[model samples]
Target: MVIRHGQASFGADNYDKLSDLGHQQSAAVGQALRDMGWVPDRTITGTLTRQKETLASMGFEAGEEHAGFNEYDFQDLLSARYKGDVPDLVKGDRKVHFRTLRETVFQWQADEIENPAESWGTFTGRVESARLAACATGADRVLAVSSGGVIGQLTAASLGAPDKMMMTLNLQIKNTSITKFVFTNSAFFLHEFNATPHMMSGEAAGMLTYS
Candidate 1:
Protein backbone atom coordinates (compact mmCIF):
# COMPACT_ATOMS: atom_id res chain seq x y z
CA MET A 1 0.00 0.00 0.00
CA VAL A 2 1.16 3.49 -0.85
CA ILE A 3 0.26 6.50 1.30
CA ARG A 4 0.74 10.17 0.55
CA HIS A 5 2.28 12.55 3.04
CA GLY A 6 -0.08 14.92 4.81
CA GLN A 7 -0.86 18.43 3.63
CA ALA A 8 2.36 20.39 3.54
CA SER A 9 3.04 24.10 4.12
CA PHE A 10 2.41 24.68 0.43
CA GLY A 11 2.96 28.41 0.25
CA ALA A 12 5.70 28.56 2.83
CA ASP A 13 9.36 29.15 1.97
CA ASN A 14 10.08 25.56 2.95
CA TYR A 15 7.22 23.28 2.02
CA ASP A 16 8.92 20.22 3.46
CA LYS A 17 7.04 20.03 6.75
CA LEU A 18 3.45 19.24 7.62
CA SER A 19 1.10 21.90 8.92
CA ASP A 20 -0.97 21.49 12.11
CA LEU A 21 -3.87 20.19 10.06
CA GLY A 22 -1.43 17.81 8.45
CA HIS A 23 -0.58 16.27 11.82
CA GLN A 24 -4.25 15.77 12.59
CA GLN A 25 -4.78 14.19 9.18
CA SER A 26 -1.90 11.85 9.81
CA ALA A 27 -3.34 10.77 13.13
CA ALA A 28 -6.70 10.17 11.50
CA VAL A 29 -5.05 8.03 8.84
CA GLY A 30 -3.22 5.96 11.40
CA GLN A 31 -6.38 5.34 13.35
CA ALA A 32 -8.28 4.56 10.20
CA LEU A 33 -5.68 2.02 9.10
CA ARG A 34 -5.79 0.36 12.47
CA ASP A 35 -9.57 0.25 12.34
CA MET A 36 -9.31 -1.39 8.92
CA GLY A 37 -7.14 -4.15 10.43
CA TRP A 38 -4.03 -3.17 8.55
CA VAL A 39 -0.92 -4.86 9.95
CA PRO A 40 2.01 -3.79 7.92
CA ASP A 41 5.15 -5.85 8.36
CA ARG A 42 7.39 -3.27 6.80
CA THR A 43 7.19 0.47 6.38
CA ILE A 44 9.07 2.78 4.02
CA THR A 45 9.18 6.49 3.37
CA GLY A 46 10.86 9.03 1.18
CA THR A 47 13.73 11.15 2.44
CA LEU A 48 11.54 14.22 2.56
CA THR A 49 10.80 15.63 6.02
CA ARG A 50 7.07 15.62 5.46
CA GLN A 51 7.09 11.96 4.48
CA LYS A 52 9.14 10.99 7.52
CA GLU A 53 7.00 13.12 9.82
CA THR A 54 3.83 11.58 8.47
CA LEU A 55 5.10 8.10 9.21
CA ALA A 56 6.17 9.15 12.68
CA SER A 57 2.77 10.69 13.36
CA MET A 58 1.28 7.30 12.53
CA GLY A 59 3.26 5.88 15.47
CA PHE A 60 5.68 4.05 13.24
CA GLU A 61 9.42 4.16 13.62
CA ALA A 62 11.64 5.14 10.78
CA GLY A 63 11.95 2.03 8.62
CA GLU A 64 13.98 3.07 5.62
CA GLU A 65 14.79 6.26 3.75
CA HIS A 66 14.78 5.97 -0.03
CA ALA A 67 15.96 8.88 -2.08
CA GLY A 68 14.32 7.35 -5.12
CA PHE A 69 10.95 8.00 -3.49
CA ASN A 70 11.66 11.74 -3.17
CA GLU A 71 9.40 14.01 -5.15
CA TYR A 72 10.51 15.94 -8.22
CA ASP A 73 11.32 19.54 -7.42
CA PHE A 74 8.82 21.59 -9.38
CA GLN A 75 10.17 24.89 -8.18
CA ASP A 76 13.61 24.06 -9.45
CA LEU A 77 12.20 22.86 -12.72
CA LEU A 78 10.29 26.11 -13.20
CA SER A 79 13.30 28.16 -12.19
CA ALA A 80 15.45 26.39 -14.75
CA ARG A 81 12.88 26.79 -17.48
CA TYR A 82 12.22 30.48 -16.86
CA LYS A 83 15.87 31.27 -16.09
CA GLY A 84 15.20 32.17 -12.43
CA ASP A 85 12.28 34.39 -13.34
CA VAL A 86 9.54 31.93 -12.48
CA PRO A 87 6.02 33.10 -13.05
CA ASP A 88 3.82 34.22 -10.18
CA LEU A 89 0.69 32.56 -11.60
CA VAL A 90 0.75 29.52 -9.30
CA LYS A 91 0.38 31.64 -6.16
CA GLY A 92 -2.78 33.51 -7.13
CA ASP A 93 -4.98 31.00 -8.94
CA ARG A 94 -5.32 27.33 -8.09
CA LYS A 95 -6.71 26.46 -11.49
CA VAL A 96 -3.91 28.29 -13.22
CA HIS A 97 -1.36 26.58 -11.01
CA PHE A 98 -2.56 23.13 -12.00
CA ARG A 99 -2.91 24.02 -15.66
CA THR A 100 0.53 25.54 -15.75
CA LEU A 101 2.04 22.64 -13.88
CA ARG A 102 0.48 20.18 -16.28
CA GLU A 103 1.83 22.00 -19.28
CA THR A 104 5.27 22.34 -17.75
CA VAL A 105 5.39 18.66 -16.92
CA PHE A 106 4.35 17.80 -20.42
CA GLN A 107 7.09 19.93 -21.82
CA TRP A 108 9.59 18.44 -19.43
CA GLN A 109 8.56 14.95 -20.49
CA ALA A 110 9.03 15.88 -24.13
CA ASP A 111 12.64 16.95 -23.46
CA GLU A 112 11.84 20.46 -24.62
CA ILE A 113 13.83 22.03 -21.77
CA GLU A 114 17.62 22.03 -21.61
CA ASN A 115 19.66 21.19 -18.52
CA PRO A 116 16.83 20.31 -16.18
CA ALA A 117 17.74 19.21 -12.68
CA GLU A 118 16.50 15.78 -13.62
CA SER A 119 14.84 14.54 -16.74
CA TRP A 120 11.27 13.25 -16.63
CA GLY A 121 12.52 9.81 -17.59
CA THR A 122 15.03 9.86 -14.76
CA PHE A 123 12.37 10.84 -12.23
CA THR A 124 10.00 8.10 -13.32
CA GLY A 125 12.79 5.58 -13.34
CA ARG A 126 13.64 6.41 -9.75
CA VAL A 127 10.01 6.01 -8.79
CA GLU A 128 10.07 2.59 -10.44
CA SER A 129 13.09 1.69 -8.38
CA ALA A 130 11.24 2.68 -5.24
CA ARG A 131 8.31 0.48 -6.26
CA LEU A 132 10.61 -2.41 -7.01
CA ALA A 133 12.30 -2.06 -3.64
CA ALA A 134 8.94 -1.99 -1.88
CA CYS A 135 7.87 -5.21 -3.59
CA ALA A 136 11.24 -6.93 -3.16
CA THR A 137 10.86 -7.32 0.58
CA GLY A 138 8.33 -10.12 0.06
CA ALA A 139 6.28 -8.82 2.94
CA ASP A 140 2.57 -9.50 2.89
CA ARG A 141 1.72 -5.95 3.92
CA VAL A 142 4.13 -3.13 3.17
CA LEU A 143 3.40 0.55 3.73
CA ALA A 144 5.20 3.25 1.81
CA VAL A 145 4.95 6.92 2.66
CA SER A 146 5.71 9.31 -0.17
CA SER A 147 4.57 12.44 -1.95
CA GLY A 148 1.99 12.83 -4.70
CA GLY A 149 4.47 12.99 -7.56
CA VAL A 150 6.10 9.69 -6.69
CA ILE A 151 2.74 8.04 -6.07
CA GLY A 152 1.39 9.35 -9.36
CA GLN A 153 4.35 8.01 -11.26
CA LEU A 154 3.96 4.65 -9.59
CA THR A 155 0.26 4.62 -10.50
CA ALA A 156 1.03 5.49 -14.08
CA ALA A 157 3.77 2.88 -14.25
CA SER A 158 1.42 0.20 -12.88
CA LEU A 159 -1.23 0.97 -15.50
CA GLY A 160 1.19 1.73 -18.33
CA ALA A 161 -0.71 4.99 -18.47
CA PRO A 162 0.03 7.97 -20.63
CA ASP A 163 1.55 11.27 -19.55
CA LYS A 164 -1.81 12.95 -19.13
CA MET A 165 -2.95 10.12 -16.89
CA MET A 166 0.09 10.64 -14.67
CA MET A 167 -0.72 14.33 -14.38
CA THR A 168 -4.33 13.53 -13.58
CA LEU A 169 -3.34 11.04 -10.90
CA ASN A 170 -0.87 13.49 -9.41
CA LEU A 171 -3.51 16.21 -9.23
CA GLN A 172 -6.16 13.94 -7.76
CA ILE A 173 -4.22 12.32 -4.91
CA LYS A 174 -5.30 13.68 -1.54
CA ASN A 175 -3.06 14.15 1.45
CA THR A 176 -2.95 11.19 3.81
CA SER A 177 -4.67 9.12 1.16
CA ILE A 178 -3.98 5.54 0.15
CA THR A 179 -3.48 3.87 -3.19
CA LYS A 180 -3.22 0.11 -3.14
CA PHE A 181 -1.62 -2.28 -5.60
CA VAL A 182 -1.01 -5.99 -5.98
CA PHE A 183 2.54 -6.74 -6.98
CA THR A 184 3.78 -9.97 -8.47
CA ASN A 185 7.04 -11.23 -9.95
CA SER A 186 6.00 -9.98 -13.35
CA ALA A 187 3.87 -6.89 -12.80
CA PHE A 188 1.90 -4.61 -10.52
CA PHE A 189 -1.86 -4.34 -10.73
CA LEU A 190 -3.73 -1.43 -9.25
CA HIS A 191 -6.30 -2.37 -6.62
CA GLU A 192 -7.50 1.09 -5.67
CA PHE A 193 -6.74 4.71 -6.45
CA ASN A 194 -6.90 7.81 -4.28
CA ALA A 195 -8.91 6.37 -1.37
CA THR A 196 -9.35 8.47 1.77
CA PRO A 197 -12.12 6.72 3.64
CA HIS A 198 -10.67 8.01 6.89
CA MET A 199 -11.44 11.53 5.79
CA MET A 200 -14.83 10.65 4.36
CA SER A 201 -16.91 11.94 7.22
CA GLY A 202 -16.94 13.71 10.57
CA GLU A 203 -14.30 16.33 11.26
CA ALA A 204 -11.76 14.61 9.04
CA ALA A 205 -14.12 15.02 6.13
CA GLY A 206 -13.26 18.68 6.08
CA MET A 207 -9.55 17.91 6.41
CA LEU A 208 -9.22 16.33 3.00
CA THR A 209 -6.57 18.28 1.15
CA TYR A 210 -4.11 18.19 -1.74
CA SER A 211 -1.03 20.33 -2.23
Candidate 2:
Protein backbone atom coordinates (compact mmCIF):
# COMPACT_ATOMS: atom_id res chain seq x y z
CA MET A 1 0.00 0.00 0.00
CA VAL A 2 1.31 3.45 -0.90
CA ILE A 3 0.49 5.83 1.93
CA ARG A 4 0.60 9.58 1.58
CA HIS A 5 2.20 11.50 4.39
CA GLY A 6 -0.21 13.00 6.89
CA GLN A 7 -1.56 16.53 7.14
CA ALA A 8 1.35 18.89 6.98
CA SER A 9 1.64 22.10 8.84
CA PHE A 10 0.04 24.82 6.77
CA GLY A 11 1.77 28.14 6.08
CA ALA A 12 5.14 26.91 7.32
CA ASP A 13 8.05 28.01 5.16
CA ASN A 14 9.47 24.48 4.93
CA TYR A 15 6.17 22.70 4.16
CA ASP A 16 7.93 19.35 4.49
CA LYS A 17 7.18 18.32 8.03
CA LEU A 18 3.98 16.97 9.52
CA SER A 19 1.99 19.11 11.90
CA ASP A 20 0.95 17.67 15.26
CA LEU A 21 -2.22 16.48 13.60
CA GLY A 22 -0.13 14.95 10.85
CA HIS A 23 1.62 12.73 13.35
CA GLN A 24 -1.69 11.52 14.70
CA GLN A 25 -2.93 10.85 11.20
CA SER A 26 0.17 8.84 10.36
CA ALA A 27 -0.23 6.73 13.45
CA ALA A 28 -3.86 6.16 12.58
CA VAL A 29 -2.86 4.88 9.15
CA GLY A 30 -0.39 2.49 10.71
CA GLN A 31 -2.99 1.23 13.08
CA ALA A 32 -5.44 0.72 10.25
CA LEU A 33 -2.91 -1.32 8.30
CA ARG A 34 -2.31 -3.39 11.38
CA ASP A 35 -6.03 -3.95 11.68
CA MET A 36 -6.13 -5.27 8.16
CA GLY A 37 -3.14 -7.57 8.74
CA TRP A 38 -1.32 -5.56 6.14
CA VAL A 39 2.09 -5.16 7.67
CA PRO A 40 4.47 -4.57 4.79
CA ASP A 41 7.38 -6.89 4.31
CA ARG A 42 9.54 -4.03 3.15
CA THR A 43 8.83 -0.39 3.81
CA ILE A 44 10.17 2.47 1.71
CA THR A 45 9.69 6.21 1.46
CA GLY A 46 10.77 9.23 -0.54
CA THR A 47 13.60 11.35 0.85
CA LEU A 48 11.30 14.21 1.78
CA THR A 49 11.15 15.14 5.45
CA ARG A 50 7.37 14.70 5.56
CA GLN A 51 7.62 11.22 4.07
CA LYS A 52 10.36 10.20 6.46
CA GLU A 53 8.61 11.70 9.46
CA THR A 54 5.34 10.02 8.58
CA LEU A 55 7.03 6.64 8.40
CA ALA A 56 8.70 7.24 11.72
CA SER A 57 5.44 8.22 13.32
CA MET A 58 3.91 4.99 12.04
CA GLY A 59 6.49 3.13 14.17
CA PHE A 60 8.14 1.57 11.18
CA GLU A 61 11.68 2.59 10.33
CA ALA A 62 11.81 2.51 6.56
CA GLY A 63 14.59 0.23 5.37
CA GLU A 64 15.47 2.05 2.17
CA GLU A 65 15.11 5.73 1.47
CA HIS A 66 14.61 5.94 -2.29
CA ALA A 67 15.08 9.05 -4.36
CA GLY A 68 12.98 7.44 -7.07
CA PHE A 69 9.92 7.90 -4.85
CA ASN A 70 10.60 11.59 -4.31
CA GLU A 71 8.06 14.08 -5.66
CA TYR A 72 8.66 16.67 -8.35
CA ASP A 73 8.75 20.06 -6.68
CA PHE A 74 5.41 21.71 -7.43
CA GLN A 75 6.58 25.04 -6.06
CA ASP A 76 9.33 25.02 -8.63
CA LEU A 77 6.85 24.09 -11.34
CA LEU A 78 4.50 26.93 -10.38
CA SER A 79 7.37 29.38 -10.32
CA ALA A 80 8.64 28.25 -13.68
CA ARG A 81 5.21 28.21 -15.32
CA TYR A 82 4.10 31.58 -13.96
CA LYS A 83 7.52 33.25 -13.92
CA GLY A 84 7.28 33.80 -10.15
CA ASP A 85 4.12 35.86 -10.28
CA VAL A 86 1.26 34.64 -8.11
CA PRO A 87 -1.62 34.43 -10.57
CA ASP A 88 -3.94 37.44 -10.19
CA LEU A 89 -6.81 35.06 -9.56
CA VAL A 90 -5.13 33.57 -6.51
CA LYS A 91 -3.71 36.73 -5.00
CA GLY A 92 -4.31 37.37 -1.27
CA ASP A 93 -7.30 35.12 -0.63
CA ARG A 94 -6.49 31.67 0.75
CA LYS A 95 -9.65 30.15 -0.71
CA VAL A 96 -8.96 31.73 -4.06
CA HIS A 97 -5.37 30.52 -3.99
CA PHE A 98 -6.47 26.94 -3.42
CA ARG A 99 -9.24 27.16 -6.00
CA THR A 100 -6.84 28.50 -8.58
CA LEU A 101 -4.25 25.98 -7.57
CA ARG A 102 -6.73 23.17 -8.17
CA GLU A 103 -7.49 24.47 -11.63
CA THR A 104 -3.80 25.00 -12.38
CA VAL A 105 -3.09 21.42 -11.31
CA PHE A 106 -5.75 20.08 -13.64
CA GLN A 107 -4.17 22.06 -16.45
CA TRP A 108 -0.90 20.49 -15.49
CA GLN A 109 -2.46 17.04 -15.58
CA ALA A 110 -3.79 17.84 -19.04
CA ASP A 111 -0.19 18.61 -20.13
CA GLU A 112 -0.74 22.34 -20.42
CA ILE A 113 2.05 24.42 -18.98
CA GLU A 114 3.13 27.76 -20.30
CA ASN A 115 6.70 27.12 -19.14
CA PRO A 116 7.61 23.96 -17.28
CA ALA A 117 10.53 23.08 -15.12
CA GLU A 118 10.19 19.43 -16.06
CA SER A 119 8.14 17.89 -18.80
CA TRP A 120 5.11 15.84 -17.74
CA GLY A 121 6.56 12.88 -19.58
CA THR A 122 9.76 13.15 -17.57
CA PHE A 123 7.96 13.38 -14.25
CA THR A 124 5.69 10.40 -14.89
CA GLY A 125 8.57 8.34 -16.25
CA ARG A 126 10.60 8.84 -13.10
CA VAL A 127 7.67 7.93 -10.87
CA GLU A 128 6.87 4.87 -12.96
CA SER A 129 10.50 3.78 -12.90
CA ALA A 130 10.60 4.02 -9.13
CA ARG A 131 7.33 2.12 -8.77
CA LEU A 132 8.56 -0.64 -11.05
CA ALA A 133 11.79 -0.92 -9.11
CA ALA A 134 9.98 -1.23 -5.80
CA CYS A 135 7.80 -3.99 -7.24
CA ALA A 136 10.89 -5.71 -8.54
CA THR A 137 12.15 -6.22 -5.01
CA GLY A 138 9.70 -9.14 -4.64
CA ALA A 139 8.33 -8.01 -1.35
CA ASP A 140 4.92 -9.36 -0.44
CA ARG A 141 3.57 -5.90 0.32
CA VAL A 142 5.64 -2.77 -0.06
CA LEU A 143 4.69 0.52 1.48
CA ALA A 144 5.80 3.84 0.07
CA VAL A 145 5.20 7.35 1.28
CA SER A 146 4.70 9.90 -1.49
CA SER A 147 2.82 12.99 -2.55
CA GLY A 148 -0.59 13.35 -4.21
CA GLY A 149 0.62 14.06 -7.74
CA VAL A 150 2.83 11.00 -7.91
CA ILE A 151 0.12 8.85 -6.42
CA GLY A 152 -2.46 10.21 -8.84
CA GLN A 153 -0.25 9.49 -11.82
CA LEU A 154 0.46 5.97 -10.65
CA THR A 155 -3.15 5.25 -9.83
CA ALA A 156 -4.40 6.68 -13.11
CA ALA A 157 -1.88 4.73 -15.14
CA SER A 158 -2.52 1.50 -13.31
CA LEU A 159 -6.29 1.62 -13.62
CA GLY A 160 -6.42 3.25 -17.06
CA ALA A 161 -8.65 5.83 -15.44
CA PRO A 162 -9.79 8.87 -17.40
CA ASP A 163 -8.29 12.33 -16.93
CA LYS A 164 -11.46 13.52 -15.23
CA MET A 165 -11.36 10.63 -12.79
CA MET A 166 -7.68 11.26 -12.21
CA MET A 167 -8.35 14.90 -11.42
CA THR A 168 -11.21 13.99 -9.10
CA LEU A 169 -9.12 11.37 -7.36
CA ASN A 170 -6.29 13.84 -7.00
CA LEU A 171 -8.66 16.36 -5.47
CA GLN A 172 -9.99 13.82 -3.00
CA ILE A 173 -6.79 12.33 -1.59
CA LYS A 174 -6.11 13.71 1.86
CA ASN A 175 -2.92 13.76 3.86
CA THR A 176 -2.16 10.33 5.39
CA SER A 177 -4.72 8.74 3.15
CA ILE A 178 -4.02 5.13 2.14
CA THR A 179 -3.86 4.04 -1.48
CA LYS A 180 -3.28 0.35 -2.03
CA PHE A 181 -1.76 -1.41 -5.02
CA VAL A 182 -1.04 -5.05 -5.72
CA PHE A 183 2.02 -5.97 -7.72
CA THR A 184 2.51 -9.17 -9.67
CA ASN A 185 5.75 -9.53 -11.57
CA SER A 186 6.29 -5.78 -11.66
CA ALA A 187 2.81 -5.06 -12.93
CA PHE A 188 0.64 -2.79 -10.82
CA PHE A 189 -2.97 -3.35 -9.89
CA LEU A 190 -4.64 -0.66 -7.86
CA HIS A 191 -6.88 -2.02 -5.13
CA GLU A 192 -7.99 1.05 -3.22
CA PHE A 193 -7.45 4.77 -3.19
CA ASN A 194 -7.75 7.34 -0.37
CA ALA A 195 -8.91 5.16 2.52
CA THR A 196 -8.79 6.94 5.88
CA PRO A 197 -11.07 5.47 8.53
CA HIS A 198 -8.97 5.97 11.62
CA MET A 199 -9.91 9.51 12.40
CA MET A 200 -12.92 9.57 14.67
CA SER A 201 -15.93 11.81 13.80
CA GLY A 202 -14.92 15.37 14.56
CA GLU A 203 -11.20 14.65 14.73
CA ALA A 204 -11.06 12.85 11.42
CA ALA A 205 -13.45 15.30 9.87
CA GLY A 206 -11.06 18.06 10.87
CA MET A 207 -8.24 16.25 9.09
CA LEU A 208 -10.06 16.37 5.75
CA THR A 209 -8.58 18.64 3.07
CA TYR A 210 -8.70 18.85 -0.71
CA SER A 211 -5.15 20.10 -1.25
Clashes of each: 0, 0
The lDDT per prediction is 0.87, 0.77
Q: Please, what are the lDDT tens digits per residue for candidate 2 over residues 1-211?
A: 8888887755667778888888988888888788878788898888899889999999887778777677666676666567798676555455776666667766776778766777767777888888887888768878899888778878998988875465556666888888888778846788988887776576666766544
TM-score of 2: 0.87
- True-structure RMSD, every candidate: 1.2, 2.4
Candidate 1, residue 103: Cα displacement in angstroms equals 1.0
Candidate 2: where are CA atoms >4 Å away? 87-94, 109-111, 163-165, 200-205
Worst 10 contiguous positions by lDDT, candidate 1:
89-98
Native-referenced Cα lDDT, model 1: 0.87
9, model 1: CA deviation in Å?
A: 0.4
Residue 2 lDDT (model 2): 86
Best by TM-score: 1
Question: Candidate 1, which segments miss by more than 4 Å at Cα?
Answer: none
